[model samples]
Target: MLQLYGNPRSRAMRCLWMLEEVGRPYQLVEKTTHADDLQTAEYLRLNPNARIPTLVDGDLVLWESMAINLYLAQRYDGPMHCAGPEVLGLAAQWSFWAVLEIEHLLLNFLEHRALLAEFARDPSVTERNELLLKKPLGVLNDALAVRGYLAGNSFTVADLNVAGILMWGKMARMDLSAYPELTRWLDACLARPAYVRLRDQARRK
Candidate 1:
């Protein structure tokens, strides 16, 4: 069985969400971000970077959340694989876009608000992040305006990947007043039973 290592609250949630969407059974192994735990030799051996959401399937070991999801979809599942070019062109498109444009901007704000709270709280950085966010949000608003999902017309791994990162902004209480379309799209995505279950499960863990 595939053994997933990481807390659900972390990027591991993406993997968890994918597994649920694929309807595959896997084992969940919890890890912590605590300094001591991260520094342990055993954990370091599993993930040299000490990051969470590492996966061990047979003798294969991998980290990086999105990559794991892509691998699973490609190897274990079919069109569900967000990485496949032919089956889910848009899936791959939005996945790449989400990581590059959306996640990059979101993380800028998150890092400022989280790891670098003092620096993030700086008016200059906050202002910059706030400004950067509008561009991507606008793009998303326009894309979702005529379409219910990010790829095709139905839910795909692309939607989950993009929406998963966007939910961070929502949790941070980021301003959404100007992006009504984006807000509406996000609401609709989160309304999915899979997403709701993932959110509830993450909260519990």
Candidate 2:
């Protein structure tokens, strides 16, 4: 059996969604935000980084949510998995592009505006980053103008990874009226039956 240790509200949600998409039975070793559980010697042996999401599949131990999703995709040969080296390259490209273009910017906004106390946060930092995000967002919006999904025409890891990263924008509550194409694409991604199951399962846990 596969054992995945992490809370659903965290990055592990992506992995959970991937698991559901693959339709594979697995155990979710649900965890909390407590340091005691995350930093235990036993847990550290599986993930030296002491992260909440550590996937243990028999002799294989893996960390990092995106990589874990990729593993599941490849292992099960799901539709999200790349069909060849060329397609795999595109998946990798979109994944990295989303992280570099939007992930950190969204995190900056969340940490400054939502995580920190009002007195401790520097609104200027979040505001500046928010402004800078428009360029990359515009690029994404344009790329998605004529397509229903990223990478290829159908859903794949490229869409899954990029959509997961872009979801932070929804959390940040950024005004997205300008990116109609992006908004349309994201709505479709989040509306997937697999993603819905993932969300409901996480909430129940």
Candidate 3:
């Protein structure tokens, strides 16, 4: 059986969502960020970085949430793969693009609002994030406007990977209202039963 390590509320949620989409039975070994368990010898052996989300399938131990999801999609989503090589590459592109291009600014504001509240608040910083986000958001909005999903019309791993990152932006209160297409796309993607099931799982104790 596949053993996925980490709390459903963390980055592991992405993998959990993917697992649901894969329609396969797997075990979720929950771990909390507050606990020092991540640094424990047992956990560190699976992921040297001591990350909350680690995937253990047979002898293949994997960390990094995006990579794990990609692996899952490629490995289990089809007899060959749910997505072809082109879509697979697009999945990697969008996932990497989200972290590198979009998440930096979103996380900056999230750090200020969620994690570093002790620091003086600056509305300008968040406003700047909103401003900085316009270009990428516009690109996504335009793309989603033309297609039902990121890679093509059909829902693919790219949608899950990219939308998962965008969902983080939404949670961080990025106010994507200006990009209606993007907002609608995200709403549709997140409305999937798989994502909803993951949310319910996260709410569990």
Cα TM-score of candidate 1: 0.83
TM-score for each predicted model, relative to the true structure? 0.83, 0.90, 0.90
Q: What is the lDDT of every predicted structure here? A: 0.77, 0.82, 0.81
Give stretches of model 1 more than 4 Å off: 77-84, 110-120
Instruction: Please write out the lDDT profile of model 3 over residues 1-205, one tens digit for every residue.
Output: 8989987767788888888888878998978775587888888899889886898999999998888888988887462255577888888898898878887787777766565666676778878887888898898899888987888777777788778777767777767788898888899989999998778766785
Residue pairs that clash (backbone atoms under 3 angstroms), model 3: none
RMSD for all candidates, in order, please: 2.9, 1.9, 2.2
User: After superposing candidate 3, which stretches have Cα over 4 Å from the reference?
Assistant: 114-121
Per-residue accuracy of model 2 over 1-205 as CA lDDT, tens digit each: 9888987787777777777777878998987768888888888899888886888899999998778877777887667667888667877787778777788888888778777788989989888988999999998899898777777688888878888877777766777899999999988988999988877776785
Model 1 backbone overlap count: 0
- Per residue, candidate 1 scores C-alpha lDDT tens digits across 135-163 of 88888888888877776666677777888
RMSD of 2: 1.9
TM-score of the candidate numbered 3?
0.90
Q: Record all residue pairs in model 1 with backbone atoms less than 3 Å apart, i.e. clashing.
A: none
